[model samples]
Target: MVIVLDFGGQYNQLIARRVRECNVYCEVLPYTTSLDRIREIAPKGIIFTGGPASVYAPDAPSIDPGIFSLGIPVLGICYGCQLMTYLLGGTVSKAPVREYGRTEITVSDSSNLFKEVTTNTICWMSHTDYIEKPAAGFTVVASSDSCPIAAIENTERNLYGVQFHPEVVHTPEGTKMLHNFLYRVCNCNGDWVMSSFAEEAVANLKAKIGDKKVLCALSGGVDSSVAAVMISKAVGKQLTCIFVDHGLLRKNEGDEVEEIFTKQFDVNFVRVNAQQRFYDKLAGVCEPEQKRKIIGEEFIRVFEEEAKKIGTVDFLVQGTIYPDVIESGLGKSAVIKSHHNVGGLPDYVDFKEIIEPLRNLFKDEVRKVGLELGIPEKLVFRQPFPGPGLAIRIIGDVTPEKIAILQDADYIYREEIAKAGLDRSIGQYFAVLTNLRSVGVMGDERTYDYTIALRAVTTTDFMTAEFAELPWELLGRISNRIVNEVKHVNRICYDITGKPPATIEWE
Candidate 1:
């Protein structure tokens, strides 16, 4: 296994995901992790994640210099590279020109890190500082036009550093470079698989939850469903799954979720139809973060109320994945958005503890574990849905009227995408009920109604995504059907913005 020392970098989890792709398990630990803890884990290799800090700053994050002499293979990226150089008595200062996107770099093929990577290749660079000189006994293995000493390696010490990021998709051969580091440099066996994770997780959960009642917030989506099944397998009837229908779900989703969990699973299943409870709380709220917090708090309150009827529940479970944690400002990363389960939890909770079994796994990895647990293929491959459900999908204050309109429009959009034989290929597709309204000539009469925005993206990992380019014919059909079939929708717009520019949900 490899351990990624996180220095508040946004891509810390992404680095671990890339390492796991090589069939090697990896975990991300904070930069403040002590040297003794690293030795206790005894990882085959160590990775330093990039952060938004200049190493020379007085308050910049730093590690113990003795970490270099531990005889473990270490790889540093971006800020990590500069920190490594600065700590090793090398020169690191601001570059003449800051590189923030894709750039071409020339590499020394002789270096083990670039074993199969091309000599001249494209890499993603996001740094203001550059390495001016290599440390003693370290060789400059890669360099770009604007920045010198783009990569450094101390062969005898098994240390490597790259000024550019190798975990992002913009770097075409980034995976190959990481694969080489994991197998060639670290000598990892690459024997880890999803099955191993499932077996280990069940055993650990059983030991931790002995003779205790567990309550799961099951949303019937892939993540929550997988978590529920895994917990049931561990404690059997001791686990109770509470499915909350907050009136913000897609068309018929609440009923569909109830039917599956109550009949299929052996655990104690309870469905709470608290539509009016949430509607009253969010009567006039418009801010996205506030809406998330209200809904999240309401969810906990509902669970607490349900737990009282069943006596005492020692633990509360949420289906929180890695993206939820990272997007909600994990470690040092900036908060892209606050996920209900992560950043939106209230200060006080009724449960003795909250357990998130799938917290470290990504969306795709969670699906793999779902399959390993023998969950039905239909449930395992269900589209990813947020814990906040359709509340965030609605742009402004959420009302029952807006919820109905959005659900109808979104169902039509999904139906057409699947009918066009593109549903499985697209990573995520949905519709947003924009607050904006416009005038239109419908049936030869002037009318004003809400506009629905459609979003679809293609991505292997949810971290970064590109807007999907649907054929014009298909897009036209979807737009035409949505306006004609869904009431209160006068216009349809397709969102061409990707993840960086716009999140998948409107709110």
Candidate 2:
């Protein structure tokens, strides 16, 4: 097992995900974790995640210097690298030229971390402070244009640090570097797999929820489906899955979800058609965060109502994955968006406790667990959908009219992608109902209507993503069909911006 210490970096979870990709089990704990706790876990390796802080700052996050003396291999990235240098009597100061985004670095072939990696390769760098000097006995192994000491290592002590991130995909060979650290340095056997995780999770759930009634928030999405099945496997009839059909889902999604769960699953399934309840609460709520919070709270209220009917439910389950938790401001990471299942929950929930079975797993990892649980591939690979549904997809207030329009347009967009045989390739694709309305000439008639924005991204971890470069011919077809078939949408535009500039969801 490997452990990642979070230093308030946005990519803390991403680092954990990368480690897990090496077929090693990893967990992220706060930097404030005590040395005793570290010794308890006895992790095979320790990783310090990069953060948005200067090591010299008065309030900068720090760790126990004793961590290095523990003899466990440690690898630090970016701020983590600077933190290691600073705590060990090395100089860490503001860089003459702050490096951000992709940068080329030269590495010595002797370092274990860069074992099979190219000597001169690109890496993802995002740091304002640079390690100016290495601590005593530490040798500089890598250098970049602006940063002289880009990578440092004390081979005898099993300590390594890099100014650039090897977790993000922008680094290209970053995975290979991580693989070297895990196998060559840490001596991990790569024995961890999804089947083992599923077995352990089921055993743990059964032990914790024995004879206790559990309620599951089943959205019929891959995450929720996997969570519900795992719970049912643990506690058969004791589990009840409550799916709230808030009017925000894609076209025909509500009915589709109901049909699948009721027919296929063995556990008790309840479908609450709370469309009007959600729409009423969301009336005039134009703010994205507000819409998410209202939907999240309403979902709880609906579940609470159902729980009362079924006596008492000791635990509530959500299908929230790693991306949802991190994007909702985990640790020091900025809140890019408030996912309905994560940050949008109410202050008080009626249930005794909330459980997220797939909390630490990534999107792809969840799919793997789903397959291990024997879930249908078609259901496991369903297009990723947010809990707030189409409300966030619509840029402004969500009315039944706007929902209908957006749903039809989004359905057409998805259908076209599937018809083009790009469904399995694209990670996520959907349509957004932008608030902008433009004047257009349709069949020689002057008309002013809403604009439809289409979004498609390809990603493995869902932490970082790139815009899918769709064929222009296919775009023309989707646009033509939406403009002609979906009413009230005259203008159709494809989102060309990537994740940094724009999220997959417009809101």
Q: Whose lDDT is greatest here?
A: 1
Candidate 1, residues 1-507, lDDT tens digits: the string is: 999998878788789999999999998877888899999999999999998899999999999999999999999999998999999999888877788998999999999999989999999999999898878889999998887788999999999999999999899999999999999999999988999999999999999999898988777788888999999889988999888788888898888777666776678999999999999999988898999888888887886677678876798888888777767864555678876652344444456898899998988899999999988776787777776788898888999999989898888888888899898899999998999999998999998999899899998766678999999999899899989998889998989999987776677
Which pairs of residues collide in candidate 1?
none
Clashes of each: 0, 0
Give residue 193's lDDT in candidate 1 (0 to 100). Answer: 94
- Cα displacement (angstroms), candidate 2, residue 466, comes to 5.4
| Candidate 2 lDDT by residue in tens digits, 18-66 | 8898899998887888999999999999999998889999999999999
Colliding residue pairs in candidate 2: none
Which runs in model 1 stand beyond 4 Å of their true positions?
280-294, 324-350, 395-401, 435-449, 458-466, 497-503
Q: Write down the RMSD of all candidates, one decimal each.
A: 3.0, 3.1
Compared with the true structure, all predictions reach lDDT values of 0.87, 0.87
